[model samples]
Target: MSKILLVEARLHLRDGASLLFTIALPLMLLVFLGRAAGPAFPALMVMLSVLTLSFTVLPTVLATYRHQGVLRRMSTTPVSPLRVLAVQLLINLVVAVVSTGLLMAFGPGLPRNLPGFLLVFVLGTAALMAMGLVIAALAPNGKAAPTIGSAVMFPLMFVSGMWVPREYLPEVVRVIGDYSVAGPFARALGDTWVGQAPHLPHLLVLAVGLVVSGALAVRVFRWE
Candidate 1:
């Protein structure tokens, strides 16, 4: 597994688009938004980092391997295809964590409730990764994964106040954002960053997403 992880890490670095989305874009957003909106911006950028890995990077890699018969070949070997997927998820999780660290180091304020923030961050990252796995499981090929992921990603971003602030959104939109995974995840993170206990409802929503999506992904996953 460690060897597989190292190989995946090399492949990830070789893929310029993957590097850009997973690392460069999030850091850029942190600098730009952190300057404009203060600590809230870094919190949101953290969410964006998770989304980039979950929606774009994870799905693409898994689908591509499946499309190329990589997963099928692995099934006949000592290396399990499931291990490959696990390694990919682990790599992306590292990227998200490192991105968050960069924000904390350079951004103005630190998360006041460190334990609470970590709780939200871990759960939120798992939920999003589960969602990404579902996409990887369902997409017929590499080309289709991005399309499906984008369809899901845009609505999530919009409802999460990526486009418009939740406070300024219409009542209906705000209500949707309240329930959407991204919205609650971002809110919980921001609240904890300011030393507040995260709202229970938000935590529950993310937990549910993690379980449901993970189950579906496992149930429907294919090697090729």
Candidate 2:
């Protein structure tokens, strides 16, 4: 696992887009939003941004690997599909944690509760990764993954009050946002970063999402 992750990380850092999205874009978001939304909200945005990073980027990268026949090629060896997926996921999770820490150290932030924060972080990352893999499974080519990823990510980011606060969006969009990935995840981040209680319902929604998405992702994912 460690070896796989190290190799994947090296490959990831070499890709300009992936590296920027993984490291720069989120930090930029944290800086801009943190300034605009005030400390409390910007702090939360860090986690929110990290969640988006995990779901959107990891799948795209994996899809690229699939397109290049890396995944298909892997099947001829002893490595399990599960292990490959696990390594990529662990790498993404590490990126998320590191990004969150950077925000705490440098970016503006609200309060934080470590225990609840970690619970939300762990579950939220898993749910998003499941969804990401499902996207990767559904999209055949690496080139297509971004389209799929954006389709999944933008709405969640938009509606989740990342761009416009839920209070600002039209009621219809607001309602939709509530159910969107960003919506629930943002709410969960609020609880985590601010030392508030987890919204059990929102967290459950995340769990259900991971289950459904993970199950489907497994069914559809192909080595080739």
Candidate 3:
């Protein structure tokens, strides 16, 4: 497992474009939108980073591996192909932590409710990644994975107030956003950032998303 992790890490590092986009894009956006977003800026930036990893990077890598027969071949070895999926998840999590660390070091401000922030962060990230796993499981091939993920990601981002503030969105859209994974994640993190406990409904939405998406991914995922 350790060897697989090391090899996978090295392979991931070779994808220079992905690394740059995942780490640099959010910081660059912060530079332009920091003052405008005010207190919500850091949370928005962190959410963007997390969403990018969960929707774009993760599914693409896993689907590509399966499409290339990598996962299929792994079945012949001592290691289970599932370990590769786990490693990929771990690597993406590390990237997310680094991105968040950078935001803390250089962004507008840190979350005031540290414990609550961590709790929301964990649940939100897990839920989002579980959805990504479902994308990886269902996508027909590498070429289709990013297409499917982006289709799902963009609408969620829109409703989550990535482009427009939730206060500005229509009441119907806001209600739907409350139930979406990204929406709850954004709201929960924003609440925690301002030193408030996350709303109970937002936590429940995230937990439910994690369970449903995780079970679906495990049930439908194929080595090939």
Candidate 4:
């Protein structure tokens, strides 16, 4: 398992295109929008990092392995397919962390409420990544995984205030966005960044989503 994790991490690093794009896109956005975009952009970009790994990179990698019979062949060996999946997830987590770190380095100051921010970040990452796992498990093939992930990603982005800030949206749309996973995610993180305690309702939503989605993903995951 350790070896697999190391190899996957190295492979992710070696993939220059992926590494550059994931790291670069957020950094560029920060440099350009950091001043004008206000406090929420940093958290949004962090969420974007998580989203990229979850909805884009993760599903493609897992589904491709299944499509190419890698997972199937691994079944003949002592290693469990779950181990490979875990390693893939661990690698992506590193990617997300690095991406977020870069944004923090160049973009904005640290979150005012350090502990609160950390809690929101951890829960948000888990909830979003678990959603990605479900997409990976259900996708029929490598090509389809990205498509499905993207389909899911755009709406979440919209509701999460990627396109329009939640504050600017009308009451109806704001209400919908509030209920969406991305909505509470951004809210909790934003609140913590500004030194305010995250709202209980937002934390509760994330906790429930994390538990329910993770359980479903594990239950439905396929080795091949």
Weakest ten-residue segment in model 4 by summed lDDT: 13-22
Model 3 agreement with the true structure over 1-224: per-residue lDDT tens digits: 89989998998899887777778888888777787777867888889889888988999999999999999998899888989999999999999989888887787667999899999999999999999999998888888998999999999999999889899999999989989999999989988988999999999999999999999989999889
Candidate number with greatest TM-score = 3
lDDT of 2: 0.74
Candidate 2 segments whose C-alpha is farther than 4 A from its true place: none
Clashes of 4: 0
Candidate 4 local Cα displacement, residue 182, angstroms:
1.1
Clash pairs, model 1 backbone: none
Per-candidate TM-score against the hidden true structure: 0.96, 0.90, 0.97, 0.95
| Candidate 3 regions with alpha-carbon error over 4 angstroms | none
- What tens-digit string does per-residue lDDT give for candidate 4 at 164-196? 877787788888778777789988888888789
Summed backbone clashes in each candidate are: 0, 0, 0, 0
Among all candidates shown, the one with the greatest lDDT: 3
Across 50-162, the per-residue lDDT of candidate 1 in tens digits comes to: 99889988998899999999999999999999899889989999989988898788777689998999999999999999999999988888899988998999899998888
**Model 1 regions lying over 4 Å from their true place:** none
Residue 130 lDDT in candidate 4: 94
Better of 2 and 3 by lDDT: 3
- What's the ranking of the predictions by lDDT, best on top? 3, 1, 4, 2
Which ranges in model 4 have alpha carbons more than 4 Å from their true place? none
